[model samples]
Target: MSLHDTSSEGRLQGRPQTGSQPAIALIDGNNFYASCEAVMDPSLLGRPLVVLSNNDGCIVSRSAEARRLGIAMGTPYFQVQRQLERLGVEVRSSNYALYADMSQRLMATLERWVEELEVYSIDEAFGLLSRREGEDLSSWGRQVRRAVRRELGLPVAVGLASTKVLAKLANRLAKTQPAHGHVFDLEAQADPTPWLEQVAIEDVWGIGRRLARWCRLRGVADARALRDMPSGELRQKCGVVGLRLQQELRGHRCLPLTLVPPPKQETCVSRSFSQPVRTADALRQALATYTVRAAEKLRRQHQRAGALSVFVRSNPFNGTSFYSNSATVTLAVPSNDTAVLLAAALPLAETLFRPCHPLQKAGVLLLQLQGEEQLQHHLLQPLPPEQQQRRAALMAVLDRLNRRYGSGTVRWAACGLQPAWAMRRERLSRAATTRLEAIPRVLAR
Candidate 1:
């Protein structure tokens, strides 16, 4: 039977006796960042490796070997620098381009097996699956894991269940429990209570720390206990959201597959500088670069921003000397042009700059975004129809060149040729997949 079949006849054939039960399968890459690094360089496999966050400041991802070595996530690199070297652990700064490319490939591979897929994050996705009465979903999941491993050289855990929450729990078990062999199907189990009992209330999906505390206080310590809680009491205390979660845990689906994601309400481009920047020229350069990025994103989405905001901030950890300010500019006519965005954003950088404060971060935010189809033109617009078309054509050409060559193949003069305040990524890896020159070479011998 075809996995994509969803019609009544298709369901009848698949279900045979008990009727079809659609399942949600959550597939997540194991140690995604670390795994992405290993994919590009096979020598790192089975070795202790860690991927650091922006500026190489914090340990954001760790391989199984690294985790076993007691390297915790979010640990400052400075504190663990000595320990990592002593243990012969490899480290790499976040390579977003490589990771993003791998993620896209992973999603495309998954699309082949599932009826509908929702990309939840860079390393995780939810696939809607139709289970036949006698078909083995666990076996099907194994095929998925093997395919991803074979194609992308990335390890993944597959969790199939009647609901998203259970699928999430199943995915966690698939990762932590060696006996599961990296694929767990909650619906396949004759008795799911035992599995649910093994999951702590705090570890359950959608249950935050506060809610976990509340559950613990109420003597609900595990998924089983929470699932069996009185519906009225759960609803009264936690509202509809809580009730929906309980329903999902009880094998009832509440959240439907989001085949098409909703349009973004705002687009923001922000980053912390490698070093504190004090000069006005540096500040303007940073804001202009960020504005260009934000505008590009808007154009890609076929949306225009009605307003732009520029914010500058000093290190919040700098005690009483901390400074932060932002200014918003409303455009007469909505636009996604980099020049238009920079024109409005650069002036705000000058206005918000404080010479005494050493700014640590700056960003550009595009607000009140509207689709091109819904664009409202202003009566006193600065540009006429022909001029607007020319500007758009120029922006399109600029974007194409950048995409074909690489980011910043063509950029605004205001962005500065070599900004000292750029992000610090000393241990950065090559963008092997995205960039032509970064591709790995193999000797004929």
Candidate 2:
């Protein structure tokens, strides 16, 4: 059935109209990075905009206007520089701080309506909604979208269905099909065959390029074909995972909403430097900075690492010479203290460093993480209770200061005063929500 044909007789198709069934909703922010930038500065609205990746290398995101202009995603910024300038397209470096702050606001707004929500990614969330008798999910979805726009000035598309996979498909249609009014509910349709046929197999959630190619070779071109494919053959070739996906498309819910996220197994902090560094001191500074970040993440999760790894690598693209090495050290006791992790990681950086090779990337990994409640005192190197208390108190003060005044307010001396190898974000926007100094000021005329 055409989405435009919404007559009761056509939509019902002998199936009873019911509203008591629960639904899964996939709410996705439209042009998330570009939307985030526009939220901060409304002047950029309706303009062709693109957000670049780390080091301002490639286009990671594009606004609707940019999409219409044929500016493909992942294109090298340098290659499109002249064209973008000629077309008067605006470009911004990836401002993660601003984007993260906007995402938090968006999620908080969604939590007000959803019974349970799973933050699937930085820009999308899966929500479980329990429908009341005679309730219209499409109406509820519109209200949610309105609230997000009013609160955060970010547009969203909502897709509702009995299962997650179908909800994902519905969400895609909600964005692409104007008749849905940015909200599509697959459960409301008596026969979803027409809609399922519209989705290509490759576009289905969890169906990667490899699986799509396999499906195509077997005459499965669209979502409906995959849904009705021979289960025995699918199971024989693609295993139980593929079967579960087919079941999901058939409106049998196999995936449940994750109300609570699992604890992180490890904390890693790694980055590519703006410029390559050849000195041992530069590598040490980079690793020390990464160690502090990893420890901060561990503390945030109320967890500590029992092992640490440090790695340094020269650019693989540099065909002249390439080098990569890593060193791991087992800690005496699980620790989230920056000083302790730094002490363990710095020496490894020194070991991995080669004087002649200009290393482009370095990182520190906090491994074998366990909750702070599971902390065990080492027999050989036991820390006194008072000393442990002091360390915890100091870290708390450091974190509090950083949160209030912005990051790097209090830092270890070893991280260096000014590192030339810092990330290149020349076009970065102000952290209006995060940093006090970056907040915009208005002047009355």
Candidate 3:
């Protein structure tokens, strides 16, 4: 791992070196997905923008302009297209590849700021600042944000606080208040309480809409009220999460930054159908399709599953013959090979298939996983060396072709006939960053 130490000179002052008074920093990309779009295309700046969810169904992300137009996140496209058209919103599908590439660059830029850090989400990262010496965390955060902006052409909001949750809140405040200049220092403020009191309880981390409503009913609608609540009572009501939030709001660090990525114990690929599916063949086809997707994810992660679990279920809300069944097939050898995994799933699919059941959803799970390198070789029986080599070559070729051309350049028949099983992406504009046809063209005509 290459490390870059670019601690800003102006930002480094009176930095403490103790774990007790640990300082934490939260850095969030401003308008992440939408910002990434603007970074790639300068023309997108200052425009009404929206990024669609799978199947282009709903707005997953929106630019500042789109937000001003009152476009809510997750608002279904079919419901908002007319209004969006009137507002002249530039709609695009969630371009994971483009966003991912930009995220990588941004994270790389941030690596210079801290010795220890954790990527909290695709667009947010946290770093430990408590152990550093002669570092003015407030200035340091601002410098880091500026560096990211300059290097990647992406703006960021940086927050420094005693705890993760407070840092998150500070980042929010930084983004909302231009006076902070995209950086917020909770510890630096002499009156952090006033700011905390003004924040709505529902807006606090972990407090959902329902939880906010419950708090509002009790007239406990602000962070100040939540902090004053008896610990025992809060625990009884909202449990440990509430206690953590209260402690965090008071500038107490509770959560530790995870230096390493957490292990994913299980992998799943499941989706509901817009319409009920009938016929054993169709159900099996859906299962197979899901299986292929699951295997692809496993391969991407460089992990192998020891089991293939397949399931088929009928609609629970249909009030009809509600049936749900699943079967797990333990692999003789853990593998990321889609063909091997799919073959194991075929038997499970056969067992789960019931005639005239009208399956509403189907999925596959890769469980009992292990690193491919750590997998033990068979003692009595093993795949031939030639076959192993062939599989490797085949998968490498498949990955290359898909990466170069686009996904599904080569696909299994089991993927099914252009079905709605695909993710909802109705509002997806042309693939502005991936497909050749979608590439922006300069027409001089």
Candidate 4:
């Protein structure tokens, strides 16, 4: 629990003393993935629906109706196959493009309302609220709720607080407690102890299982007890991080809203195939596609991977002949160039692939990532400047065309034409909301 930079923490005026206004709000999309599915196709409304993970293996997102019927999250689709059919449950494979577009729109709407925003995840964000004379913070939070609902057709819960930690706790309550308005204000609480006590020690945002165990060993059972413990004692045990969470529990600002996210240390693109692949060539096809995806992400982020790893595995469902292997290739020069990545990756995939066992999945991982500016040129093995520039320009053009038209509008032949190892999208929802050409048609009188 190392502390993040708190340079922009608290309110503009500073941490308010007694009876001050709320300064932080945690905005979270309700049932984000399921909601995304429902909003795009209103026909799913009030229906028992679950979005499956890659390979249609398991339920990753379930609508409220599906949950009510005891369809547990992460339950393998096979395990619940009979229940789903009997209950007339609808299924959709995850459409990340649609979800990502919706998330971008949601965050864009949020940015317009806040002074500063920290996007915590695809479905959660922390927004800073500036104290204003005659401005009701709670009302402002409510407006955010309304705006997202009306503009994006997305349901969100707002949790207003004096500190980010409390704001997170408030948001948790807003989600769990029916009595709390979709927007709950923790700053308004004269004493947060009672509410904090109700929250489990593990449920606090930063308190993971190890921390929870440590707290229990020290006789600090719940968040309230943790807050009541001397700040110095916890600091001694967990260093500055423990002290900060302790202070945050007592309604003090120790964590700041981050505007810029730290770059990913590694980029991985992988997925299970629709069916088992027994041939090395099929695995090569899968690896090439994943390499393209991973490299595309690396280039888009303005970073280059110094090492590439190729991994393949047999189906977990098959106990016999179960095999998985991975191999890593270190580059002489770091690059985001797709050609460079594929050249190294295909060879590794060939070595890692075992022809005897059928592969359920294959993947590519780009490691030792650094910004493009940090790349060091090899003294003797110099990449030709003219050729490099041409490839860069070509990649840029490819990305632009794909974005403007649709994904796979332009793809490398190495990825194979009609890859048989492609993941199943038999029950995939339409990307009407994301793709320019897929927008739904309307019938008029």
Q: What tens digits encode model 1's per-residue C-alpha lDDT throughout 1-445?
A: 3445666644422212333778789999999999999999999999999999988889999999999998899999999999999999999999988998899999888877777789999999998867777455898898889889998999999998989999999998898899999999988898999999999998999999998999899999999999999999899988999999999999999988787789999999999999999899999999988999998999999999999988888998977578889999999889998888888888887799989999998888899999988668787765677988899999999999998878998989999998999989999999999889998999996
The candidate that wins on lDDT is: 1
**Per-residue lDDT tens digits of candidate 3, residues 21-62?**
578888888778888888767889999998887657678888
lDDT of each: 0.89, 0.88, 0.78, 0.84
Among these predictions, the greatest TM-score belongs to 1
For model 2, residues 13-70, the per-residue Cα lDDT tens digits are 2122444677899999999999999988999999999999999999999999999999
Model 3 C-alpha RMSD vs. true structure (Å) is: 4.5
Q: Write the per-residue lDDT of candidate 4 for residues 62-165, one digit (tens) a residue.
A: 88788889889999998988889999999898898999999999988887666677989999999875554334366667788888999988999988887989
Model 1, position 441, has a per-residue lDDT of: 92
Order by lDDT, highest first: 1, 2, 4, 3
Q: Record all residue pairs in model 1 with backbone atoms less than 3 Å apart, i.e. clashing.
A: none
Candidate 1: misplaced stretches above 4 Å? 1-19
The root-mean-square deviation over C-alpha atoms between each candidate and the true structure, in angstroms, is 3.0, 6.3, 4.5, 4.8
Model with the higher lDDT, candidate 1 or 3: 1
Show model 2 residue runs off by greater than 4 Å.
1-19, 132-135
CA error at residue 348 for candidate 3, angstroms:
4.5
lDDT of 1 at 52: 94
Q: What is the lDDT of candidate 3?
A: 0.78
